[model samples]
Target: MSASHYHICSRNIGKPVEIRTRDGRVHRGIIHRVDNRMVYLRPLPQRNYGGYGYGWGWWCGFGWGVALGAIVGLALLPWFFW
Candidate 1:
């Protein structure tokens, strides 16, 4: 696992982030938690309606677990982009 990715993820808890993994897939979600081997993400609700923001979308109770070792790139999303 990349040490920088771990530190960045840990420091940015509760913030929205987009992560690109080594396998070429991208994951977008809020940083829920971080650990030695993985980072848990609270998935952003998919917007099915006409507006934007957190309030309008389907919400899942569980968060996603991504291995820090698989991450190739990660960035914090600005409020206007969410």
Candidate 2:
């Protein structure tokens, strides 16, 4: 990730974001928290449950909804550099 990526995450705290990591996995959720190393994501309520309401929520480290890269905020325009 670039420095601007962290900048975007910092500016749009507490907003919805979609993150695509280097592994090709995509995570969609709200921005629970952001720091120098990682960006925590709180997954949507409906997507959290599997069948009988047995599923995990947001995590800190290597798990669901936790992405390490440039985060795209759903409610904001993509950052552009000229």
Q: How many steric clashes between backbone atoms does each model show?
A: 0, 0
Instruction: Give the per-residue lDDT digits (tens) of candidate 2, residues 1-82.
Output: 4467777777887666667666666666666677776777665434443556545444544424444444443334233210
lDDT tens digits, residue span 1-82, model 1? 4799999999999899999999999999989889999989998756556655665555567888889989999999985685
- Which 10 consecutive residues of model 2 have the lowest summed lDDT? 73-82
What TM-score would candidate 1 get against the native? 0.80
For model 1, the local distance difference test gives 0.86
Candidate 2: residue pairs that collide: none
- Can you give the TM-score per candidate against the true fold? 0.80, 0.56
